[model samples]
Target chain A: MSGPDPERFDAFDARLKKAREQRQEAPERGAVDRSGMGTGLQAGIDVVAGVIGGLLIGWALDRWLGTSPVLLVVFLFLGAAAGTRNAFRTLQRLMEEGDRR
Target chain B: MASPLDQFIIKPIIPIEIAGADLSFTNSALWMAISVAAIYTLVMLGTRQAALVPGRLQSVVELSYEFVASMIRDNAGREGMKYFPIIFSLFMFILFGNMLGMIPGSFTFTSHIIVTFFMAACVFVTVTVIGFMKHGLHFLTLFTPPGAPKAIWPLLVPVEILSYCVRPISLSVRLFCNMLAGLTMMKVFATFAVALGIFGFAPLLIIIALTGLKILVAFLQAYIFTVLTCVYLHDSLHLH
Candidate 1:
């Protein structure tokens, strides 16, 4: 393989280096890089955390409603709905952004 | 009424009980087949008419291909491009499964631990095996930070090991629980919206909002899964 174009390489490197110098707050860059392991891991953490948190809320609601399995069952379904909804929105966003290009 | 979570209960068309386990053709499995058919039809029709300027069909197909390609490129780099087939298939499957599950009485496979666990475990095992295949037992060194003090090795190593072990569990539970909760909530609220018998829109509006949110969750969850796969591949290749 010949390797990436030198000009493109220089442009890419320059943007990254410049972004780093600016402390990563540009439109093309950000403080948080959602590029690798961290993004996915963080998402996993968030989802797990959200579910547990939601369960607590749901369980409490169940108690308030004077229903045993009701809240647990209802909120579990709600949580799944929320998760799937988020995933669909993300897909549309990605595709839309891709279309913009 | 029919149990708040009755919708999520995947009844099988062909109830096949071999010995003990409930191995039946569940609603989830049915929807999965439908999703696959949809994909097949879309791909076939989209690719059938190849044009230079590109029609709507061609554009849809091409854009999807490029979208996934760019995602893999950005996250997994050029080397990981080879896994595009697996990654794209996964993205589509999860995406379809999620969206279809949102259609009122449909079953969300991702809401099941067995399904999500299987998917996450595939990523975990694939990456681990890939890491070893690429870097040998040296991949174990991934647990140790690059510039950490030797004193912290014992502490960090065990923590890292535990975190790694929990990977599949976390991934599986997160998807499963989220779907389970969302579907059940929708059902309960819908029941209330109807049973209110007097003032209805209150629960109706809430469930509508929740359903909308569920659609967002579906895409986000799939993206999360795919990104994590890319990250794992990245770690396997880069070892950091």
Candidate 2:
């Protein structure tokens, strides 16, 4: 078969380029971007869970060892520290993810 | 008006007690079974044709597969592909569970801490086991943070270990609380919409917005849960 007309081929190529540009410029509607609220909620929960986990461990150890409130007090602080660390790490990861996006 | 929390109450459908153990199939269990059945049907429908050019159902299946596959590659690296089956199953299960729960009267099993905790705990155990298996005794070195002064080892080590232990708790609580809070808030707003009568339009509008938000939250929570699991897997697979 004879080659297609040059003018029509050029027009089609330009149209295809424009469509590709538009697709690249616009965000993908199907893939929802991570929201600030979701990230914030996650960070907050991470901190809280860290604290809770530490407290539980401390409380259990204290009860088992019959140390009364001494170990409990120490663990409460350690748990808070751990929780803060986790929250800090979460925020850091969020920043890294944002950079990647 | 029924209490907003009433939606969470588990009532036994088929109560079976054996030797003082309560083996009851409740509404929660029923919904879980329904979710599983719905997922199975969708996957079966999507894959049965196996067309070269995918139809609508096949497109959905392919899209989800690509989504989780990319998510795994991005978060967990190439080696993590081995665990794709478990990760994909977890994602689909939670996604379906959350979406189904959005139905007006469906049970949200994910809202329960026990269910989420069990899943999270399993992931934690698996990841830990994999780390130990791969690295042997070297896995213990994971607790020692990189570039820390040797002097503060005592303080930092405990903190690091505690934070590591915090993974499962954080994972489970994040999902459970989101579902619990979203559902409760919607139920409360729904009650207001009913009680307001002539001025019900206010809460009615809020409920509409909240409904949309809850749907987004449901999907987001599932995505985050899977992503975090991948992250944890990545950490175990490659230290630091």
Candidate 3:
């Protein structure tokens, strides 16, 4: 609701962002957003999360529509894309922050 | 027996037809409005009472805030904080859309290729502009992998261009297809669970498992979309 805070990210580069979310206080979201190997790990997390989310609705729809897998397939890809995209942004943000300083 | 897919259709409440184009606003529009309102209210309500100890609602709100904020911090950095409005808004939008679709008789716009594609396109185009603006034509260098032999430039360049152009298409289709397919399978399996009488419990159980997974997917998908935007932004700005 409120505008975002205008602070830059932490001092760590891709490495620290992956090693631990200490951020100095980098939470899971922050961890995922930061670059490094963490992005890959987070990307996997993203896909699984999406598939889980999609399956629920797909089940409900199948019950309603009598069509299976259509929604499941569609939403799964959606989740994967969503996950990959998130990782991409996190990597860039970290790089940019490093460059800024 | 109404087909579930029928419900996904975008029928116009207020038809807008122009020059052989049908860009009508439908119940989907109504639901989209509702989703936005619901997300805004819940988030604001959650954050409005930011607590030291944290209330139940506030905790959940904080989790989301921290989750997304951490994501930006992790990926975008302190500077990425500047785009919080866009990132946060985008996350909430996807989250609400996904969650709302989980409800019965709801339209899953994200399941539609057009909708997801457009959303992805926005990220792709915006990131490109940011890249060009920030780094000038040097961003073009992103097409060339650093270690590639110079002789292969003619081949690799086209492939790179193709991949870059396909970003939004891949991004959007992935979301749309995943959502649509997942939703469709769940619906179909549910029918089996019911039609098989007591034996339907197996499918039902599977569906239940899928449900839990889907919730994770909802948040993950939103996170993924936003983070990708950040990554692309990073690439654009740091092309070298």
Best by TM-score: 2
The residue-level lDDT of candidate 2 at B233 comes to 91
How far in Å is the alpha carbon of A51 misplaced in model 2? 1.1
- The DockQ of each candidate is 0.06, 0.78, 0.04
Q: Which is superior by TM-score, 1 or 3? A: 1
TM-score versus the correct structure, for each prediction? 0.70, 0.93, 0.68
After superposition on all C-alphas, the RMSD of every candidate to the true structure, in Å, is 12.2, 2.3, 13.5
Docking quality tier of candidate 1? incorrect
Candidate 2 residue lDDT tens string, B37-57 = 987898899999999999999
Runs in model 3 deviating more than 4 A are A1-101, B14-23, B49-53
Q: Kindly indicate the candidate among 1 and 2 with the higher lDDT.
A: 2
lDDT tens per residue, model 1, B58-175: 8988987887787788778899998899999888888888888887556777788788889989988998898899899899998786798999887556445444544565566666
Q: Candidate 2 lDDT (Cα, whole model)?
A: 0.91
Q: Which lDDT tens digits does candidate 3 get at residues A1-101?
A: 46654443343455567776655354323323334543455444445444554555456677788888786665555455544544464355556755644
Instruction: Indicate the docking level reached by candidate 3.
Output: incorrect
CAPRI-style grade of the A/B interface in model 2: medium
